[model samples]
Target: GVSRIKEFDKGFQEAVKLAFNTVGIQNAKPSNEIANTTPKTVETIKQQEIKQEIPSNTYTSNGVKYQVATTGNNSFLLINQDNNKVVANFYPSSLPNVYHVEVISDKGHYETIGYSKDNSIIIETKTGDKSWVTTTYTK
Candidate 1:
């Protein structure tokens, strides 16, 4: 059965090649012929490295001061200024100027959505069961 299958495959390949030749289709150039063609010169560009300054802004929410800074990897760190502790991490969401905030503490782990507008960041945080509290931090 295997030998018969091999013969059938060989015959099919030949028939396909004949059909291509009948339609005036030519085979691709061999690797050596392609390599012998004239080589094209590629222009090299010297680009200056651009340095961007990351903004570290401080804001206040309910009289508590917080500092927000970029982690340089498309994420923002929310730090409490009183003790310099990272309270939450904000990651960019699909929507523009919107972020998903996550907080982990001895109490529990909480997740919420936040957005930046003007000079303020408004975040809707989960407080108790089925309760969402909105807080706005302004620069």
Candidate 2:
């Protein structure tokens, strides 16, 4: 079984190398520079700009930093210095019996995340709703 797995892995590696050579970046490592080979569509590029604008998320040219707000929801605001616009707005949803609240923004970055009854955490940050990065609750 292990031999079969190794053989499959070897074949996959060869195929990947062939694909890389086909694209002329033969020695590319599967990292950010290599993975970003797919050119961003105009819309996706816009979204990144929007994501950067959201003050609630605290994204900088350096990187997005997650911070727990001290003033609570909505009070935390960030102005996108680059675009001269507001970043995000936080609010509670009317939906009954829900854990997390909603963070809405003009840049189309909306999300809801909260803890579960079973002592687990859930996050939704998709088109309609997306769950992201649930970790073992610490502190």
Candidate 3:
């Protein structure tokens, strides 16, 4: 009976290996090896996540430069490159590639609308006299 049990166990082990091989999962690592490499794998994944979270490129318009960066939570910041200050906060609009921008100024807060396409961003703002002025920034 013991011999029969041993034979059954051997067959089960071979069956498991064959099933793994059929599914193209050969050379399965032992638990010890997997544990040893897990930290490195986690570190690599963390690095990739950090890269994905980083902000995108800088764009320029009218000799003034601007950088668009993510502020998390689906929000963004528009930074003025000349003074390195955050000039505006950008929130995503319902339309694709469009954002509602709030310009920060010493005078007061003003709202604008902007759209981005390819390497350019176009913003339309209302002047004090209620005239619309459009500015384009390019990468």
Candidate 4:
């Protein structure tokens, strides 16, 4: 289990770094080459697939079920089976004006998006703190 945990941490860091680097390099790369290129290997193709964002069925956790939806004015998150949509708001609590909202989707799901701050949410898949990753956007 320790080895597996180490492996996952390594992979997670590599994946995060690769994502940041890709964003930085994307503009510098020729658009025509990027647009026309095909995946050279199955692994590359899979990576491409993983980068795509797709909507999933609604879900919840513990005693609550939830879904994230967007309207013209605001992003809404509905909690419980009642399906009441709450307007997502961000303001900093205990840390200046920086506010954050955290959402954990159904288990086994990975999302790089969060409200208020980019990647500021944490999801615990295991029984420890290491099960989650968080990124906070700083002003």
Candidate 5:
């Protein structure tokens, strides 16, 4: 039964390759190719280091770095310098965080941006009046 199953699998693979070839794509691989493939050595793996750059006019507070760019009055964009992505948005609010801008919002709704005890940045977005979505960014 094991040999029968192996034969079925091989036939199915051949059928798939034929179907791919009919569509002008070659889905063929020699059995030795998989065994001959190169593996990553310790030296190759060590070359992959985390890359990050802090642009000018960045804000650093609580050991977290952010590229702060003001978009409007009392509104600024918070870009995670290490990740190079817009992680939080700051808006005018009576209440504030360590950045001390005011309120934080994602899409015109009130949100909160603060640091946790571990020194990571935390962003809490309010989807509704009593609902919140919290996101934490670790350095």
Candidate 6:
């Protein structure tokens, strides 16, 4: 049961960080990786392959505490528990095809390339180099 919770947490947090790190407007199509894997994962979840409802866990990294929760349908909401405000939301739309993300922060705003094998979120800009940021929230 704990392992199941961890995996779902893994999926949710990575998706959130993927949205958070994306800075700047970018037009992105889901990579072959997402197209190949996400649909099955989402479908499996829909079929109850994995448990969906899990309690939010808190982790402190560099003095920042995060509350990550899985709402539904592979969607997650992250909040700054210390501040009691929303941090970012990561939601998957139309799996097995193109999944796009939008993250807005004081730093910048960008879109998602979905999640990667290494669990890092890559955000791309419309007409520029690709920048990557690794976010750790622990499963």
Residues 1-139, model 4: lDDT tens digits: 1122357778777777766776674446557977887767855654542221212245444445545453322323333346464423222233322334444444443333343323222222233655654432221
Lowest lDDT 10-mer window, candidate 6? 114-123
lDDT of 5 by residue, 2-108 (tens): 12235777877777777677788567877997777666775455555422121226566557677766675445577767877675655543333333223433544
For residues 81-132, write the lDDT of model 1, one tens digit per residue. 9988887788876556788888755677788888788788778877659798
For each of the candidates, the C-alpha root-mean-square deviation to the true structure, in angstroms, is 9.4, 18.2, 14.6, 21.0, 16.3, 26.5
User: Which pairs in model 2 have colliding backbones?
Assistant: 54-87, 123-131, 124-130, 125-130, 126-130
Score each candidate by Cα lDDT: 0.72, 0.41, 0.73, 0.40, 0.53, 0.54
Residues 1-139, model 3: lDDT tens digits: 1122357778777777776777884686569866666577667665643212223689887788888878875568878888888877877665556778888877888888877766777778887897999888787
Scanning candidate 2 in windows of ten residues, the lowest lDDT window is: 49-58
> Best candidate per TM-score, number?
1
Q: How do all models score by TM-score?
A: 0.55, 0.24, 0.54, 0.23, 0.29, 0.41
**Cα lDDT tens digits for candidate 6, 28-133:** 8779976676577667667754322332567454577768666776666666778776555666544432224555667776666433222223233354455555
The residue-level lDDT of candidate 1 at 51 comes to: 34
| Ordering by TM-score | 1, 3, 6, 5, 2, 4
Query: Looking at candidate 6, what is the lDDT of residue 70?
Result: 69
As for TM-score, the candidate ahead, 4 or 5, is 5
How many clashing residue pairs, candidate 4?
3
Q: Rank the candidates by lDDT, best first.
A: 3, 1, 6, 5, 2, 4
The TM-score between candidate 6 and the true structure equals 0.41
- Tell me how candidate 4 scores on lDDT: 0.40
Better of 2 and 3 by lDDT: 3
